[model samples]
Target chain A: MVNYIKLIQNENMKIYRRVGTWIMLSFIVLIPILVSLVVLLAGGDDDTTSWPLIMLESYFLFSLIIIFTVVVSSDTVAGEFSRGTIKLLLIRPWSRSAILLSKYIATMMFALFFTIVAFIVTMLINLALFGSTSDSNDLGGIVSTGIVGWGDVLQYYLYQFVTLIIIVTFGFMMSSAFRSSGLAIGLSIGFLFAGNIITGLFAMADKVWVKYVLFMHLDLTSYMDGGTGPIPSHPMTLGFSLGVLAAYFAIFNLISWTVFRKRDITA
Target chain B: MSQAPIVRLQDVTKVIGKRTIIDRVSFEVRPGEVFGFLGPNGSGKTTTIRMMVGLMGLTSGDIHIGGHSIRTDFPKAIVQVGAIVENPEMYKFLTGYQNLLHYARMNSSITKERIQEAIELVGLQDRIHDKVKKYSLGMRQRLGVAQAIMHRPKLLVLDEPTNGLDPAGIRELRDYLRLLARDEGTAVVVSSHMLSEMELMCDRVAILQKGQIIDVRSIRGESGVGSKPTLEEVQFDVDHPDAALGILEGQGSGRISDGLLTLSSDRAGIAAINRRLVEAGINIYGIRVKTKSLEDQFLEMTGSETIG
Candidate 1:
């Protein structure tokens, strides 16, 4: 059997060699720095000591990270088909499942790399601009006194990353199912943005099944700061939300593997 | 004679959405020979190539490479085969060296020195570090051949390898393929719609029409030990074409075109005809014999309408 690591290396080479990947990566590093610089130059009350509050605001850039990852992951398999390189790849000594797994792993690695870069860049810039202060209760609701630490923020980022994985897997699924990068990317980002608004309407229905929807559970960070369901009126546990997300993740992977493994590469 | 066949397709059939694309096609290719899949466009040449490399599934039959079934033993079977199904679409962002390294890393046995050797083999040593986007089509073709032969596969399959190339480039590739087969004992498979190219490059050719193998014939030089006399088409450029036709007394059906009498005759028959024409004072200016080409035979076999 060929080493699966080499296959991932091959994929990573193709990904990083493109200039577009670098462009997306640059935005991750620049957007947060620019946002913090605006605070430094324009606002006087939001001083350097309130970095955590600024980070709370910066966490919204996860949407940007998610979109960037969606673009990269969406092109994982479909790009090869559109470029006609899939034939060369499929004819190698590896099996179809192995190749698919390598692509999947490589795309997730790309997501993780972006998330980590965003985390580091955002943390550094916020630390450099607004020094560490625990005065903000964007999560202060967890405690009656509105006091929290870095641990809660770390939990928030970690949970957000878990959702990122599920979303990346969804994009990978679409790429395999549709075999078109544009369609896969379109559906993935659309699911993220529109699903948020649509789930808000569905979350208000008060039905027992309302909590089981995918987008309702995507904001895993909502579980932070003593949060229950996305609907604050309806109480639920993190375990239930995790279970629903896990089920969708498993289904998405199953579809991707089945479709790609059995596909006829006529292109 | 002791060498076994490197590739064998047994009763292969392919059906795509109620349409039979390939129908019970079977053939074998031995090592050290260039076997051709000659057919018109949309004639399953690309489909068969895709199936051979396990890119497409087998509907009712199996292809064996190096005695390993491609349907079941894909990794084992495909490890012995090297192919380019269509155009050599490469990652244009990467250098030629990186592209070769990408494939080299797939197989564990290929080393860095082997990659350097392949680069030199394709004469891309100077431009090996340049991105593929800067490469000409002919250069890409050489790179394609280099990748296929680098791993030293037992079977090398190239589909429509001569799609766009100058005559000089085509001849160079033809000579190189022949040398690779002869020196390394690798069975080479080339698919082309042009009969003249296959006749010059292949040892044996399988003519396909509408997904069926209509004929499989040896296109190489026939051995002289056969019992049947070799026939040659001798053309006599004479002053009186009609008089030359009458001197023959209608022994052979001869065609007269542009003041030349052309007839199919053996060497001995040519001497007799020449003597008869000399006795008849037909004033023969030149007598030239030409070997028959497979173009006429291919046209007759496929009925000329299907050639693209």
Candidate 2:
């Protein structure tokens, strides 16, 4: 267990040491402050309705988090192979699975760190610009029939985080299967956007098999928003969406682990 | 050297598609000895080393390190080994000390003092905190060696370790490897096409040709002394080179060139031939021993295949 922790620590150190990682992190913090400054400069109404604005800013920031997570996870394994560092890493006393698991854990930690930083920066800036209020307009009509409050706001971010995990894991799986980080990132982001289109197409079909499609279940927040998901007639519930997401998560990780463990460090 | 074998390859073979990258090659490396691997380009030296280090899978057979099989119990088997497969590729973003620290974390036995000692052993103390991207190739190689020894592994495997080192750096690396073997009792396996460096560094060498073990030669004699003379072309500078060749008629064949008679003979045969030549009234100017180098022997054994 201690050795595993050491491996994770080493991986984290590698990630943090890169200038690119710091730049990405700085962008996470800076983008929200920049946006807040722009809104204030543009002379928007200061009606003390800060929660809704903060949540909106956070939603925008979360999209960036998704992009950053996908990019970082894409680079985690494939970058090692391209750089020939996998040879150095694989010869260690730890198992191959352990080394890969440490990388996954570190990438996840990076995602969490960025999410938290963006959340804090957006909250601080919005509070300074528009002040705090207990109004429930921050729910943003995602929940139509509930007394949406700070709890729902937290749940919204949590749901976004859960969705980001699938994207990150998808990128990670691509990385393990391929040696080019660019290809992984391209495929992952392509999938993220293309999945919605595919889900929309599937929604038009009355076929029962469309319910089992992966992308149709990726947006777990649809259930939180009291919407019937992309397919209105399908009666998508939170439990069912969570179950589907869990299955896809398992499949993604299974593919990543198997491919990473079985890969030969030829380069 | 009666130490137990630290590494053993038993008929290890690797096939990629229809090509056999490594044939049924087998060898053993004992503790506290430096074993050299030599082969021409595309001869499977790196392939074999990769298999030994578990960087590549073997098509058949197994590799046992310290009584653990790599095919079955990889972690247990690999714990005894520290290897740089080809060039030592590290995270260029991290400093040299950070790189060593990262590698040291993989094993529980490696400590802070040991990391410092490895850095000092490799003579990277002054620049240990510099990022690896700022380092020269030789400095990177030194840092590679530092990381490889931090765990005090029972076996150290290095492929082309002296690729970019200057002569002095190579000598320093050689001395450090020797020290590792002698003091830490680590079995060092080094593969290189540099025959001269191999001659000076290795206790014994196994030469490979076309993915097969062609010859295993001891650089130093069995008794560890320079007394036992091997077969070499002894050059004799004589007053009358043609007359000296006539005196050696019944002995091995001889050729005269530039007033020197050259013939293949051991130490005793050279002594006897000299006496016969002197008695036959041929005054000897000088007799020089031209020892057959590893390069010559490698060329002869491998059918003169050029090394890359």
What TM-score, computed on C-alpha atoms, does each candidate reach? 0.93, 0.90
Candidate 2 lDDT by residue in tens digits, A1-267: 877899999989988888999898888888878877776777764433556666667777887888888888877788988899989989987888888889999999999999888877877887787666545453335424342345766777788898899899999999999878999999998998899899888888899888888888877667665677657878877777878888999999999998887776788
Local error of candidate 1 at B79, Å? 0.8
**Candidate 1 wrong stretches, greater than 4 Å:** A45-53, A134-148, A232-234, B223-227, B230-233, B285-290, B305-308
State the displacement of the C-alpha of residue B164, model 2, in Å, after optimal TM-score superposition: 1.1
lDDT for model 2: 0.85
TM-score of the B chain in each candidate versus the native B chain? 0.94, 0.89
Angstrom error of the Cα, residue A191, model 2: value is 1.4
**Candidate 2 chain A, which ten residues in sequence have the lowest lDDT sum?**
A138-147
Number of clashes found in candidate 2: 0
What's model 2's lDDT at B49?
93
lDDT of 2 by residue, B95-136 (tens): 999999998888888889999998988889999999999999
